[model samples]
Target chain A: MSPVPVLPAIPGPPLAVNLRSAQLVYGGLTLFDGLDLDLTGGCFTCLLGSSGIGKSSLLRLLAGLTAIGVSGDLRGDDGLPLTGRVAWMAQQDLLLPWLNVLDNVTLGSRLRGERPDRPRALNLLARVGLADAALARPDTLSGGMRQRAALARTLMEDRPVVLMDEPFSGLDALTRLRLQALAAELLIGRTVLLVTHDPLEALRLGGHILVMSGRPAIVQTLPDLPGAPPRDPGDPAVQAAYRAILRLLEVVT
Target chain B: MSAIRRGLATLAGVLLTWQMIIVIGELPPYILPNPWAVAASLGRNAGSLLSHASVTTLEILTGMVLGTMLGSGTALALGYSRRARRWLLPMLIASQAIPVFAIAPLLVLWLGYGMASKIAMTLLIIYFPVTANFYDGLRHVPPGWLDLARVMLPESRRWAVLRHIALPAALPALASGLRIAAAVAPIGAVLGEWVGSSAGLGYLMLHANSRMQVDLMFAALVTLATLAVGLYFAVDAALKRLLPWHPANPETTETG
Candidate 1:
């Protein structure tokens, strides 16, 4: 079968991310040390690792959301600061309970005391299939719907880079697949680094898959597959990649 | 609706019991007035009671406003600066250690016998709970929400995070503190009036008791109780309207 034209090529020159000699220590236990990673920009990279292997911590380091005393040499390809140019989505939807769907989507702008672009926010809500729920409070939505609204908020930032921590982990299989497709389609041109424990999810959504394992975790890239994401789940090539990832994850665990 | 009905029923039962005790014990009006006599007293002294009640109500309201401002302002200051928290937290906790009633005479002495002393008394009683509860709420903003704030907000605009995120997030807690403050506000005002005052239900009750006007004292006591209950409900209703997003039955965890 021909490759589906759902995902457009990432726009502009992708920002490459380089982290060297990164070290994080929590009391007597070392979570990461001498860690090095080179990430291609405008590409979706999925990070797979065992629980407590510091995958989320690595993402935090990249997002500069890590606590103080964390030492690292982190730089973007463009040499510009990565601070305001990146958008992050967490496992929980993290929608402010007080704000309605539309208001949440425009929260960033409102936080900056700028007038929110209501039309753009409404358009994004419509795209997320939540146009009718725009005025509804976030607590009123289901888990999947809340995540979709969160995705709309992430996209509304319109940043060049997006960092997500298990953004679809809480959803059911069907909702997860639908959202993965939507995320791939919507986040096509941005540099995205997603952390997940699901090998199949990583294979389906990521352009590049990296595994972090062992004490003071280190990253290793998996081989690139044939098709672009969202990949055909039934294809043997996808299955082959899936098995390889499963075996690697097994070895790590 | 059912809760209101239950409350009314309970009130009727209490009134019936009070009347029964008075009649069965054959207590004189000075020692224990019957419900009818108290009701008559309330009606007969309505004008005097209303004026005095108004004074106490003003003191409570004024003190509540001032105390809430002082408490929330202090909480915000402490929440934003670690240095402030380290320096002021112990002092705040120590302030609560001294009984507010113990300070009533001192407040009256300092602020004099007018509304200022009564307002100061209520403010003293109210300041601690509002500060403690609101500070807890501000500090306990879900780490996930703060993480989102850090990623989304620039360093220079950090105050925006406090204003938009932390402040609103803490409102439900502040509402609880305000409710508690409203319930106890009258105690301070009445205590100050009892210590030394020209007007208010507290002064009237004291004067009537001294003059053997037992019915008038009962009327003043009833007026004070009504003011306390009314103010509490008013503040509670306002908080519910202001913080509509706060779960009505928050004690139960959501299964979903």
Candidate 2:
């Protein structure tokens, strides 16, 4: 085994996100209207819903990437704006095909015109199990490997809050589960808002669970589970919670 | 090796067909010269043909460089500024509506019947394809990429996103534009020469035809065809090298 660069200590404290009176409309369709959301600092929140329920849109809105027709006052724990302090990972790996894995990991810094921290990026790639592919282009890597590189890139941001939109949904089931475990392990003690379609994925990793549903989508919080996540997917309690969420969403009803 | 063989085979076939047509029609050398007579003229007038070919090549090459630079600058400007898009883009479209041939005579009058007129014609011919294709490419960079760039690098300088992302993303499209530009470059230069030029393959062909030198005219036509084909392939090869990351056709290029 090759020696790995040590992961640097995580930067900044985790930030709780508070959104009040959020309204988002897409082309005359109101996705979220006057919706309020609260996710505690240093905790993981999983948001689940069927397609067109606006789970992804809600995440984008929080990211401040909603270009138009959105109104929200979203803040961190310090009662300041949370616009620049959030790291986002989306369903597609979105690694620039022209850049190698290492360069892609440090893309944020380069784009910001800052000197990239090459060692830290290498360490993150190592932590994500992609150190060997540091110089490889995105198209040369498999989907799972590409997503791993993306995870490394996301971690490179070192922000207080992390938002993921189905970051594992595009992978094969086994790869998705493995990546979920990896993401769960790496993202500990950060304000994380994850949107996923899989109830089991939510059961395994969500510290708190919220279901976004309704005509103008609204969130419904579930009762607290017994322990910290990433909980064992095979655990009976996790299984029970999964079934309950399915029933709640009327997936099997 | 196979590419060379295939090219030689096509050339041989073309020559054979030409010779057969001349022999069967009993055409005189003055009207439709025999392939042998054309080759003889090519050898006899090699010096003149080479000089004229060089002149045309220079015009096309200079035009290619200036046109690409101007077109790329325009695309970036159009992309970078709303004012440029709103004001310049309509004018650009309207200019294209005027047939270039109609303006060729005016350009010859203004720039004179020298290399300037020919080079200007080539630049005019190549500019729009490069601009439109490159601008379209710049505009169509996956929205996800820009969104991500905005989120991650909010403090990026005025042109940081354009430089780092949009420009690189648009290169493949720019290459497509260049391919079209290269193919048409010689046509523009020759068109200018035909309208009015001191020296070029077009001028040589016209002069040869006036003097009843059909074989010399055919030789000049061959020289022009060779220059156009050669220019296209050279540009194609250079593009492939410059954009190694952007393989011409990924699915086909990757056999391993």
Q: Measured against the native two-chain assembly using Cα atoms, what DockQ does each of the candidate structures obtain, in the order listed?
A: 0.70, 0.74
Candidate 1, position B246, lDDT: 89
What is the DockQ score, from 0 to 1, of model 2? 0.74
Please give, for residues A176-218, the per-residue lDDT of candidate 1 as tens digits: 9999999998887688999999888898998998988778777
How much is the lDDT of residue B13 in candidate 1? 100
Most DockQ-accurate candidate? 2
Poorest stretch of ten by lDDT in candidate 2 chain A: A4-13
In terms of TM-score, how similar is model 1 to the real structure? 0.93
Docking class of 2: medium
Clash pairs for candidate 1: none
Pairs in clash, predicted candidate 2: none
Q: What overall lDDT goes with each candidate model?
A: 0.88, 0.89
lDDT of 1 by residue, B119-233 (tens): 9989989999999999999989999888887788757676889887889999999998999999999999999999999999999999999999898898899899989999998
